[model samples]
Target chain A: MARTGQVKKVGTALAGVLTISLIAGVVFGEGTSPAAPAAPIPPVVAPAPFSPECQGGSTEIVTESPLPHVAAALMKRRTVRILAIGNSTGRRQGGFTRQIERLLKQVVKGADVVIINRGVSGELAANASLRIKNEVAMSNPDLVIWQVGTDDALAFVPLDEVRETVESTVRWLKEHNVDVVLAGLQYVERVAQDDNYYRTREMLRDVAAKEHVMIIRRYEAMQFIAAAQDAGGGYGPDEFERTEAGYNCLAQYLASAITVGAFGKGMSARPLRGPPGSQPQQPPQQAQPPQQQRPMQ
Target chain B: MPRQSNAIDFWRGIALITIFINHVPGIYYARFTHANYSLSDSADLFVFLAGWSLRYIVGVPDRPQQPIGYLVLRLGGRAVELYAAQILITMIAIAMLAATATILDNPLLLEWHNAAAVFYDPIFTHIGLAALTHHLGYFDILPLYVVLMAVAPVFAVIDRYAPNWLLPISIAIYLITLIVPLPIPTWPVEGQWFFNPLAWQLVFVLGFVMAREDGIGGFVRRHITVLRWLSVPIVAVSAYIVWNRMWPDPTLMPQPRLLFIADKTYVTPMRLIQFLALVALFSATYPYIKRWALRLVEFGSMLGRNSLIVFCVGSILSLAGQITRFVYRGDILVDTVVVVLGVAIMAFAAWLPEWREQVRLRRSAQPLPAS
Candidate 1:
């Protein structure tokens, strides 16, 4: 009798487990896969033309290599998701993330652009690297625009730690078939002479070159803009006001640079079609001769 | 200070102190925290202990369970309190940052710890803050606690009616979440919560389950020696992995990648498992700890007993510490001063209420001295 009761209890527990699993399965399994993406809508407005003040220093906008995955996704699916990580991406009015989305839509015509802005304020590169991996797993973004170096530089993090973290993370992203755009430190006039600041910038430049990824040379662009503004007249605005304008110009530059990187060899080879509102175009910027791809050790 | 100090409270106090130290990012002492050596940090202990404490609130074996409606209301009230606390402290933290920014004339202070949104997009960010959709870094855990508390009644109902089904149900939800990307998304910023409650609920449930006298609790107590022995290798190996920073790449894992990686956001299986093992291994050390460090044990217990308030004050103090460190350029001396002062204040914050309660108890026992 005792043995029979024990068997009956075990049977009951097994039945309960199966019932719960089935219920949970039915509920969660229904929406595990996202809805099939809608057909691409033709962009109604032309890509925002580069602000003339934001223009110039054409070399700063160069893409060293193509973002093959972004290009492929745009070709095949007509949709691409870009995860923007860093402290600086969260400027007042949706910052560069919104600008990129708008520019990509206008630039690519029918390609759908989704920018997942995962920027946290005061985040260093080493910390962002960890969060970037998980965000990649969850969001499955085709490209990541990492606004790195600024916080690390300010925090006085060692250059080697920054390099190792960025290099390893970039390699990891590449291995996972995701493209990366390293947006280097934001330029501030006061920090121009700081050794740590310069070292962080140099480190990022090195990582981008070493990893064979496109880098947004924000420092060089901002520096050029600052000099042009100063020569044109007095210091353009107070430090705070200039920071805001700097962010706007950064958005414009990044939109152009990222679009160029995505379209890559294709953009250079074809006769470029200018957006309706912009001047009849030359290729967005002087494209760097493509570097030979090297395998990461 | 509370007239009694127990192991759970002592451990909680230790976790609180660790959290306080870790929140000041550049503090030299931060390197010495359990996070440096363990896969699971104070967060795991804090959340697990939250679940363990929930067992007391819901019911005890010897005490009659409160009426179901009253129980639900109690949990709801607690959730409200936590929510209120989150809003209050977040506001104060922002104010502190803003004040520091103004005093120093450095606008960068406004950007620290995801506070830019609160200033930049105040209207939407305030709405997000109130709705618990936007959270600041290092100040996010409470929102998760509020959410877990809000759902406590369901766990209670399940435990009441089908006692055996609770853990299985929690596990099912956890597994389903692992397979499906069902994280609660953040708003006003397109992202997921830093602490995904769905994945984290399992640890809380495990804590609750293990705190009870029957089921898993009784089983654990009975075989604790053997389990402790088994946990030794998990703890030792995890320590080595963490110390060496041998964490695997999340993207390299197969589908349901979250399950394989040692991610804190999702409180992945590896973290959850290691946390449990660490708990198992450490749970036996209370007697030894009391023997050698009774003063430390008492201090930790006092802090643990008033965790919510201490945590709130500690959060503000840590933010202040961060600002101060930034201003001073964070040398050893700056870090030392920030840490020492911040922790000293936290201790006082914890002690203040207990002291008040003790006075109240003394007055009540004095048989209305004025009359």
Candidate 2:
């Protein structure tokens, strides 16, 4: 009797299941395979316009080689090669690495600069250090522009560890005789107010000075622009007024400064100041015009 | 078993409340003080809770007969209710819009004035379509809930027949959804879409499986400390990534790859892990909070019991409050008054239906010896 009861229960449950399935089928099965073409696959290589900056110097483009085990390739009687490695910030259209490529191409004049962007967002300094050999060395570029540290600051990686990581990275590049440009990032908002930004910047600066590699004062340039805007009566209320313009100006300044600092003399010769020792004082030069002088209102 | 897992429902109620707070449009404590909490995070939590709750309520062994039928009815009923509610609310919104146009003498909603052009834009049209389809508004979770619940039986069968293969299948599906693109259109072009099912299903599955396990409650208790400690780094890393990537653009459309990876649409891996971390942290510290909340006695239990009613009414009230904002034109005091009054009125509205039902039940229970 008990066995029969169990069987009856199971049968009832199965019947219920079938009924539910039928209902679901009726509801969701409508247009189950709606007529449409397959989605288009994104192109692997997006068409990028070459910049006018890479025309005058010995510019090395670092990118992944197409054919394996080919150190240098002759494509239509011109060598095509590139080295790509860094974080997501390095992979943007206007990111530091791309800017470097544009400038390098402009300096070399008609030399095809194949700059590869291997920047994955959210990568930590430790991860970069671990992957340096495979991602950077394997590419075998003549020059490497290593832009990192943003993730490290937010990750709370120790200042010493950040310096050690960068130092080792530079050493590895130098071992392969790969010229290195160690780029520094500047403060945007809260980061500028915090002590960690300055500490990280100083650590990078010290490493660059010790290693005799090129140091780009990206942070100082940002401060200069921010200070200039603040001095000229505060910038607008929105983020675009505050950081977008600042980031663009800073990025432009960094690219130009790195090129100048590494290869030749340009605007980078100007003295770079550190973060304010205390709360920022009112700009030494105040706003002049009466129209601009409206009180805090 | 009669599915002795009401604990998850309590947690789900809390998740729903968080979602309600997130959907409240105007500036509140969440805006100025805790702006870091994204609307996406709330959606992820809700999806996870939904999956978890399904497993708890429906997938137990030695269960009642007609489980699948019961589940389907419950889901279908909720969907129907949602559609009906949305139609009513949309009409109310349209009416409110028309009334405001009259009061302001703006002619924004009047077809003759041609100011209806703005009102007839995709924002309203899409919301209108959503209402018609029973999809609710952009922030509505009911449509996604309906879809997820419908699929639960299939998952349950897989759980029963091939338990060992479940995790691998789920992970494979999740990875495919993550790497491969699935383009689903959401309305308003710029308005937020609440949840995505593809990435989100993993959380639901995880919750479902965890609920089925014999030692889940004990396991949670045992690993509380380790889980709490682990949450710190997880939160920090996720926050850093979100701050760097998400804050730059708050708009819903033209979503970047990071948003896809975050996957509020269908509970992506990152969201699942983050939500689990949050749950762990909360459960570990819940004793202190439970003690305090319990101290409130009558109000706490009443609020907890009628959470669904509170949520529905709260949502409608928030919309009313938003309309008042238009009427008052950004007067902070007036907005606050409107919101407070809206909340009271909604709470009262929720009480009315229940009161009527209670009265009917009392009358039905009256002695009928003469009859």
Candidate 3:
């Protein structure tokens, strides 16, 4: 009985030691390392030329940010892998990934753009952050286009939770050498007056700025397009039909945004105006005249 | 005769209730569910108990003697029934979403829970939905259950003939899946199933092996006290891990990373092991629960007896609760009302069939004068 008691004590001590070791391993693990090392910045190049189908005259769809990995992949292997993720907005822009691939191919003269869409409907930012890790493990993309904020606004997820989840996920991605572009909310009629919606959008903008990544500023773009078309009397009776058109136009804008983000060089670190009266963080850069654009192939 | 309230049914009923609450994404009560603090949630309990319950149908000694072919046919029919239930609930859920969208004049409602394909790409989405390749989020588990039931006959065959081989074969398949990460892909929406059946089959097999009276199950029953004592730290540490949200980065992990992560879709080793420890620790609670609250035991057992119908009803009610929360902005009062009414409706759903069965039994037992 005494021997058995001694053996039991030994087993208990061993288990205690093992547990402590596990806790230590978890506390000071691989994730503690800082993301975004000081790698030399790639030289800027001309933004990929837009397709004739892309509209919204000279609107700066993406703010100035460096996509060094995408540029390196394009330069060395002539290939870039992109993952489009987030809420239902990822699905709303039909065939936008194909358009991005096509435009990049046209511009880079043999670029192989591989895009995978992993969008879940009505997913909040926190949940999407978890899924992003799983998908990155599986897909190994060089760039992640995250359409965010709208669902969180609608679901009333805490603003702090949104910020923390997005910031940490963005940092995690950067640490793993993946570039990110945050696509902000859509401009739906129902949420036009929602303070939470606007705040969530602004919060996302702040996240992009703090992270030093580009944001698509989708809400501002959509708002500009809506105001321009309405003033020009381009309305059919069906507003849903206009939403479809808006999504199509959004596709073009996203494709352009990806192009500018991947290849645009020497862009000042400033936001640009989409149309007159739309929000811009800096003095508007004059949009190149329509005549300057290359005609559609 | 079977007891009015058994551990299996009571625990299954508990799982059903927990699942109902958790399915409502942002409910006030959602924070109170086991998911908030445990590595394994009701889904694991539901699936494990499902495997445990199947031991009776697999021609064990305690079960009445039945031919293997009959058992196979019964299991096949059950698989078909689960398939039908899945299709029916999916149609109802879609209609609910569509109705809400039209009533609110909000197209975004149509986009909720991966229903965009059904609205925008109806032709292919319908085929995908019917084939069980397309599933709405929070409405997915039935497909996994269907697959498990479909394969149960094969498991039973192996278990009956070579009992020792069943677990090792299941573990081999699970390990292979984790290494290769060969998930069952979703159609019409380039993705994978939320609950990957290949990796999940191991849990089911474990539950089955532990339910039997020979080999593993008998050994476990004989040594349950020691196992329970050993499980305490595992359960405690896992709860701490979940509470503090200490998840390892999947990307930094070595190859065969699915084996290391705490992913629910693949049901990783951590989750599986923690869940088994949880089962070991909690397996002793039912008798105490019965002693303290007999009414609760009876209520849970009733719900467990008609688990399929209750689960289907609970799932639909949970979706409705989500919609309710969305409409009302999810305060404490709204959550209370949604959960209270939803659970009541689910209980009613469970009771109705049993009441009808009892009625039929009484009529059959009565002597007919004219006939």
Highest TM-score, which number? Answer: 3
TM-score (all chains, Cα) for each model: 0.83, 0.47, 0.84
* Tens digits of per-residue lDDT for model 2, A1-297: 000000100111122222333333334433434454322211111111111111111111111111211112221323334454444333122344455556445433354556544443334564455344443433445555566665455434567868877887777666655656555654454356557667877787777767666555555544544554554434443333434444344344333432222222111121122233222223222212111111000
Query: Could you tell which candidate, 1 or 3, scores higher by DockQ?
Result: 1
Instruction: Order the candidate numbers by DockQ, best to worst.
Output: 1, 3, 2
Instruction: Provide the lDDT at A295 for model 2.
Output: 9
lDDT of 2 by residue, B146-193 (tens): 456667766766665676566578777767765553423333222123
| Candidate 1: C-alpha lDDT | 0.74
Per-residue alpha-carbon lDDT of model 1 for B1-371, expressed as tens digits? Answer: 36589988889889898998887775678889989888899989999999998998888534547987899899999999999999999999989888987876666566667777787778988889999988887898899999999899888888877778999999999989888867787767565687889988998999999998878999999999999999999999999987886777677788778788878878989888889899999999999999999998989999999999999998888888877776667778988898889889989999999989889888777865554
Worst 10 residues of 1 chain B by lDDT: B60-69
lDDT (tens digit, per residue) of candidate 3 on B75-190: 99999999999999999999999998888776667767878778777888899899998888788888999999999999988876777999999999999998987888777776
Question: Where does candidate 2 stray beyond 4 Å?
Answer: A1-297, B1-13, B32-40, B62-67, B107-138, B159-170, B187-194, B213-222, B236-267, B295-308, B349-361
DockQ leader: 1
TM-score of 3: 0.84
Please name the candidate that would achieve the greatest lDDT relative to the true structure: 1
Per-residue lDDT of A17-40 in model 1, one digit per residue for the tens?
Answer: 323333333344334344645323
Q: How many angstroms is residue A23 displaced in model 3 relative to the true structure, after the best TM-score fit?
A: 54
* Reference-based lDDT, residue B322, model 1: 77
